[model samples]
Target: MFKSILVPFDGSQGAEAALAKAAELARLCGAELTLLTVYRHHSLLEASMHMVRPDEPADLDDIMRTHAKEVAERGRALAAESGIPAPRAFVKGGPVARTITSFAKEHGNDLTVIGSRGLGSLEGVLLGSVSHKVTSLSETPVLVV
Candidate 1:
């Protein structure tokens, strides 16, 4: 039985499906459910590529982090609605799959549940889905929904 379950959420339909499944498992096992939303860190170099504008976000990383926080909260709400009263949620910026695995390891998660496909860029399609990469990289057991 899983004591702790981690779900990597990205505001995608696939991710929402994974969250629902993970929450169901957590409830069945009476496990603690954790949600994480990771945003891609945009370096200054990448920021410079975009045309500067007064209305545009001055710091892309900050904007990304802000959006990530919203996504995390939404996931938390979903988990709460699913039966877990108060699920823990977090927001981070980094390489998505690596960050997820690292967070799971750091937090001593027994199970990681993720979506088979998510809101990934073309790179994901070219290389592999985040779930695929996480399955390959993670030492903990991963369940892809």
Candidate 2:
């Protein structure tokens, strides 16, 4: 039985499906649940694309972090609604697969339940999906929904 379960969520339908599965497992095992949302670091060019003002320089990291936090919190709320009590949420900026695996290891999570697909870039489609990379990299077992 899993004692700690991690779910990497991206606010997509696939992620929601994974979350539902993870929540059920958590409830069954009486495990602690954590919802993780990872956002990529924005380069200056990418940041400029999202800038609100033409001349104003916004802190892209902060902007992205805030949005990521919201995504995590939403996932936590969904878990709670699914009867998973007090689910924890975390947001980080990094390569999606690496960040998820690192967080699971760092937090001593016993299992990871993730979506088959997420809001991945074209590069991910060309190379491999984030879920695929996570499954390959993680020592803990990964269940792809």
Compared with the true structure, all predictions reach lDDT values of 0.92, 0.93
Report clash pairs, candidate 1: none
Which tens-of-lDDT digit does each residue in 1-145 have in candidate 1?
Answer: 9999999999999999999999989989999999999999886777776665556767888888898999999999989998996899999888999999999999999999999989989999899899999999999999999
State TM-scores per candidate.
Answer: 0.94, 0.93
- Tens-digit lDDT track of model 2 for 1-145: 8999999999999999999999999999999999999999987787767555656556778888998988998999999999998899999889889999999999999999999988988999899999999999999999999
Task: Kindly report which residue pairs in candidate 2 clash with one another.
Answer: none
Best by TM-score: 1
The C-alpha RMSD of each candidate to the native structure, in angstroms, is 1.4, 1.9
lDDT of 2 at 6: 96
Residues forming the 10-long window of minimal summed lDDT in candidate 1: 49-58
* lDDT computed for candidate 2: 0.93
RMSD of 2: 1.9
